[model samples]
Each structure stands twice: as structure tokens, then as C-alpha cells.
Target: MNPTEFLDGGTVTVSDETYTVYKTEHPESAAFATIQDENETTVVAEAGTVSGENVIESEPGWKRLTFEMVLPFELVGFLAAVATALADEDISIFAISAYSTDHVLVKEEDVPVATKKLEALGCAVER
Candidate 1:
């Protein structure tokens, strides 16, 4: 997994069962332009969500990126490692996942350090 960190997302949550999200034309979300309104939900970041409905709100000044690698059921440690790496650097990350891979978001400036930290933990990432 040649890890490439693309930090550029914002944190957001939904109050309803359905909402729309806008993507920045990133190659990652090329498969789906919008995640249809569904019952399942979790913390979402605005960085990937170009636009959305259901009264979406979030913390300002944050960034997001998809992990450089693909881990199926190994997300537990993947997340732990990410958290550990960021915790040590005093950085915060908000993460989400799709059926194929996971997405993590940190501050815009913290991208460099977060990238290095995750790389040290055996996760492939790019600067």
C-alpha cells in the first residue's frame, strides 16, 4: 500500500435518514457522486461532502483524505494506528469508510505530519 495522505475534509453529521453530499471531483469518489440518503449513518466530514442536505453541520477548518491502501476487515487496527499516530502528533482526525476502503480527515496544515505518522505505522501514504 503506497500510502498517500490527501488531507482535505470537514466533519459533519446528519439529523435525518437522508442527505446529499458533494465531492471535490476526486478520483476516489468517482464511483458515486452522492451517497444516497440511507438509514445507516455516522460522523461525516464536509471536505468530501461538496454539498449535502438534512441540515448538515460540522467543525470548521478541517481536511480529509482516503487511505493510500485498502484494508477489508482490518479496519480496527488501521483506525487504531491512525489514531495513535495523530494522537502523538497532537492532531485530530475524523474518519469514515466505504465498502472498499476507509477515509480519514485531519486539519489542512497537519497533512504533512499525519502523512508521515501513518507511514511510520506501516500504512502506505503519499504527501
Candidate 2:
């Protein structure tokens, strides 16, 4: 199947809350998404929620664009297509994949352009 075909009839919704990506020594229970590995704990949460000593690094002002569709486990290249679309426009993204769908976090300043890029790829964007 074509990579962009997955976008057909799908919607990309922009979240109102700005988020921050934090690399912390310990897991944050309140984080929107947290990944723990032998190296470190990466936490994504609303800006200012996770901070202080445990946090080794923090990058704030990210806006989440949620692909509001259930992507089948067998689907291929969906995220690659989306990332490529945004990259073509020089927008960087932090991606997260859930059991049902995927989300990409772009710098807050790039939301407008990113929205347009996603829309151009056949996904309706909800700002």
C-alpha cells in the first residue's frame, strides 16, 4: 500500500496544551508518556509539569499533532511519510506510538506550517 494512503479519511488534531520533553533519572508518574530504558527515563508531559533534580534535560514548547485514527499493526511507512512531509519543510518532530495510533510533537512555532504539511498529505488537520 502507498505510504500516504493511511492518511486518507484520517484527521490530525492539534493539542492546545504545550508539552515538554524531559530526560530524567527517575520515571515521572504524571507524564503524558514515559519511556524507561537502561540508559535513562524520557518523559513527555505538559510544560512545567516535570522538573527539578531528577530531570537531566528539558526541551519545552512542543505541540502535539495526534493522528486520530487507529493504525493497524501491519501498516507500513505511515510515520515515515508523515515525518518526511514535515522534514521537507524543515520541521523537526518527536514521535510517539501508542497501541492504536501515533502522535508527533513539533515545536510550537512550527504548528501552522506543520498543519499545512499534514493537510497536503491528505489528512484533515484540526487546529
- Count the clashes in each prediction: 17, 0
Top-scoring candidate (TM-score)? 2
Name the weakest run of 10 consecutive residues (lDDT summed) in model 2.
1-10
lDDT of 1 by residue, 25-75 (tens): 222232222344344223343333433443244344555556544465633
Q: Which digits, one per residue and each the tens of the lDDT, describe model 2 over residues 5-96?
A: 77976899999999999999998887999989889889999998875888899999999999998888888999999999899999999999
Candidate 2 accuracy as TM-score: 0.96
> Per-prediction RMSD in angstroms?
10.1, 0.9
> What is each predicted model's overall lDDT from 0 to 1?
0.49, 0.91
Whose lDDT is greatest here? 2
Name model 2 segments beyond 4 Å from true.
Answer: none
Pairs that clash in candidate 2:
none
TM-score per candidate, chains pooled: 0.53, 0.96
